[model samples]
Target: MIHLERVNGDTIWDILKLTVADHQKNFVAGNDVSIIEAYIAITSNGYAFPFGIFEDDTPVGFVMIGYDKDEYWKDAPAIADGNYNLWRLMIDKAHQNKGYGRQAVELALRFIRSKHHFPLTM
Candidate 1:
């Protein structure tokens, strides 16, 4: 079964060993520290989140969610209020077609709802 879990600095660091070194579109390329830094930034702000999508406890993708357009912008009338936005989501190419992506996304949504501490769901 696939699962979604919150990412800490340690887990993010560990995943670097597997997230590939050539992905640059959304991930930091060439170095793992870039990933660590990105997650750290997210956690530090209290307004963003990142989740590790795991299949049978093994990581397969990264899903980033965050509260939108804060003070910098009017926080546009999102998909809905009290709902965060998915900033970037990527499944490791190796794991893309094995039905894990669907499971991973479902897992991510669950994690996000839990993180928000909301009893209501989508």
Candidate 2:
């Protein structure tokens, strides 16, 4: 089963070691870079929340949730206070193509729902 864990010091190294395939390298930024960006965004504006994807306690991927009112939504009044973004989602090259990505997204959406900023219909 796929699960999410806070990306603390213990799991940071494992997440940093994850990478995409050579042919897909240009499509996604390295986890190391993403983590750094997440950290900066988190500390500066309290928006990004980074997590490590785990399967049976083994780190398999990384995902981050970013909430920004101005930067993301162009200041939409309805969602002005809360604009949730699935900022990043990545599975290691070794873990790709195994349905993990879909599961990870499911887990992320579930997590976001639990936070419950506004009503979600349909």
Candidate 3:
């Protein structure tokens, strides 16, 4: 099973470690304390909402979905006009294609819907 929940101050560490570790392995851009710190900084703000994706009890990946651009990293894309950005739609290598990414995306969408953030699905 897959699920997504908000990454508040309490849940940031696990997601940070998992995400940075994956980035260290898969991303040519590299991952480090500084990068993870940057993610933490954004999550501390109101403009971004980060979610942890889990398979059963273990974290599989994380996604930060929101509209603000100033909080993103230099490499991250700016959200389109009137559209929210779905950043870091990642599933761990061990869990990829088990449909977890879709589930996580759906959960994020549903949660967004509850907030009345998006009037139309894109």
Candidate 4:
């Protein structure tokens, strides 16, 4: 029953507590940082939708999707325009290798399609 839950006051702490493996530390940013960036994007009139990947009541990971009109993307390549980026996706070290990552991505794509009415590319 893996699904995406919108990150909010009630679930922020749990989501922030999730972490990747030590070897992956350099690759994925902490959930706290992701949340902060999402905040910045929203305040800057951009779109950042952060979500907690959960299985039933347990929080397993975090994922975020962003639309490209933000000031941060002004200098980004043309491919960024009118496109949705799978900004962040990370499963806690304990939750890795359980296929949750793949499932979470599928859920994210469905979410994006439902919200934006556009097919996500890449």
Badly placed stretches (over 4 Å) of model 3 are 19-46, 71-79, 117-122
lDDT of 4: 0.89
**Judged by lDDT, which candidate is best?**
4
Candidate 3 minimal-lDDT segment of 10 residues: 28-37
Q: Write the per-residue lDDT of candidate 3 for residues 75-118, one digit (tens) a residue.
A: 64434444566655666566676788788888888766666553
Instruction: Give the Cα lDDT of each candidate.
Output: 0.59, 0.79, 0.61, 0.89
Worst 10 residues of 1 by lDDT: 28-37
Colliding residue pairs in candidate 1? none
Q: Which candidate gets the maximum TM-score versus the true structure?
A: 4
Every model's TM-score:
0.60, 0.82, 0.62, 0.91
RMSD of each: 5.0, 4.8, 5.4, 3.6
Residue pairs in clash, model 3: none
What's the candidate order when arranged by decreasing TM-score? Answer: 4, 2, 3, 1
lDDT of 2 by residue, 20-118 (tens): 889988888888887887877656654677889999888899998776643433544665355678878899989988888899889888887777653
For model 2, name the residue pairs that clash. Answer: none
Of the two candidates 2 and 3, the one with more favorable lDDT, higher being better, is 2
